[model samples]
Target: MATLGFIGSGNIGTNIARLAVAAGIDVVLSNSRGPETLAATVAELGERARAATPEEAARAGDWVVVSIPLAAYEQLPVAALAGKVVLDTINYYPYRDGRVEALDTGKSTTSELVQEHLAGAKLVKAFNNISDFHIPSLARPAGAADRTALPIAGDDPRASADAADLISRLGFDTVDAGPLTESWRFEPDTDPYAMPYSAEPDAMRAFWAAAGEAIRSGTAPQTPPHVDQGVPLTAARLRTLLADTPRKLTADRLVA
Candidate 1:
């Protein structure tokens, strides 16, 4: 069993950590606030989890999840995560993250910027599209008739596989949404980016198609996926909404 390190142990980080532990993975948790702040979470996760510094967590994991706010990407410990599988669960909201002209102008997606910072880390974009509140409760057994699917995008095949494997253990299916450059498809405005997984797959595809168009047209307004806390999505409802839209391969060059 590989060790999973989390760089931001907030709502999403802690939820995923709990799920990972339940799935039999060891987790090392960190945050901008330091190890002491995660005492309760560490206590809850028991022997399977340990709290550590961000750099320490980065160095300790076979797989690392970076769940910090997009604005703080520059703060990630690039050198410590080299050659590691890094799951990027970041989404940009101008109001919360302030303004980054490059991202706003479609010059670069947030993951790309993180990749640039941690050039040696194998980066995968996932978990960002789902709500923190629902992550822990939604995982089901692999191939369970009712398992929901989550979208993942990354530049590295092996790293993506590793991420998908981790996702599977958490009780959901994985959709390879292409390379990190196409991660914009799951950005703030896109249908799949934040929509409740409870929706049927067709509705999900339709929502993403509609949302993707909104992004291409420069009209996304930081709207999140519709969610009502505590309500779990049905498996059939999640599958019915899956679609087969053409995968996008965006220009590799980040906007200057």
Candidate 2:
């Protein structure tokens, strides 16, 4: 079984690790605080999971998940992650990450910045769009009638495909949203961000398209009301709501 290494074992990372463990995949978890701090999490994950330093986790994982804040991207072990398939689940929050001029100006997306730093690693953008609370609840078995779909963007086809496969193993299908540059479409404020989709593939695609239309037409809700509620969204219903709603980007909004 391939080991899934985590560079930051926070909420999303920990949840992913849980899913990986349940799927029979071994996991090596790490965080900035240190391996010692992850004792509880490691114990909870049982024999299949162990704690390690960031560099050790990076070097050990066949597929590494970099789930740290955008502000901490530079601190990642670049040399240790060389040639690894990396899944990036970072989102830029101005208040949390401080104001990044490039991100504020739309010059670069968070994942793009992460990709630049991890040049040797094949980076795929995913797990950022969904709420951490919904991850575990939303996952469903493959081909199940209600399996949710998540979007992924990456420059490398092989790497993206590998990410999609891993996501499937975690109980969600993947919708290819093109390369990293186009990843902004699914970023914090775009149509697909945090919007729950149906288990049916076509329904999921329609939800994405409708969300895109709402965003393009300046009609999507500025902040998703259903985020905390975990609304069960369908393509047709989401389309109507998105069209009727209106979005307003604040001055502090993270661009690109």
Candidate 3:
């Protein structure tokens, strides 16, 4: 089995590790907090998973996943990740990541910044648009009636294809969203960001309506109800959503 390394073992990272383990892959998980902090997660993942430092994880796997916060991109070990195929699952949230002048100005995409940071790595933008909690919920076997497809972007076509193949093994299908510069097609707030995989827009709207009514009536729960199930997204459907989206971020909404 192939080994997968993770540089961040938060919700999405651990979930991806789960899927990879299920698909017969070994996983090395790490986080900013250190490997010892991940003991519980490693135990839950069984024998195929182990915890290591970020650099060790990067160097140990044939392929590595970089799922850290966008602001921390510069902290990635460039030399360790050199010449490696890296799957980037980062998205920018100005409020949370502070602000990047380029992203604010539409001058660069998140993956572009990451690729620039990991100059020698083969970077592919992926898994950024889906909700962390919805990953395993939406994955389906290849060619299944409800297989979900994700969009990936990278400058190198071969790297993108390899990423697509690896992601396929993990359960979901993939659609190339062009190069890293074009990756914003699936980034935060875009048409394809979260809805297509969560549920159809109509379904989401209905859920919101009911939630609003419950809130207004003072009958809402402490937490909002999750959409009952996800709607599968086909590659063609994902392509159309990506095509229909026009860049929404314009001038940099600068922050202090």
TM-score of each: 0.80, 0.80, 0.89
Model 3 over residues 80-196: C-alpha lDDT tens digits?
999999999998866557667889888999999999989999999989888776788988788888889999999999999989999998999998989998998998768898777
Candidate 2 residue lDDT tens string, 16-62: 99999999899999999999999999999999999999999999998
In candidate 3, clashing pairs total 1
Q: Which candidate is the best by TM-score?
A: 3
Best by lDDT: 3
For every candidate in turn, the CA RMSD to the true structure comes to 6.9, 8.1, 4.9
Q: With candidate 2 superimposed using the best TM-score fit, by how many Å does residue 244's alpha carbon deviate from the native?
A: 14
- Point out where model 3 deviates above 4 Å: 200-224, 250-256
Off by over 4 Å in 2: 197-256
User: Each model's C-alpha lDDT?
Assistant: 0.77, 0.79, 0.86
Question: Candidate 2 local accuracy as lDDT?
Answer: 0.79
In terms of lDDT, model 1 sits at 0.77
Question: Which residue pairs of candidate 2 clash?
Answer: 219-245
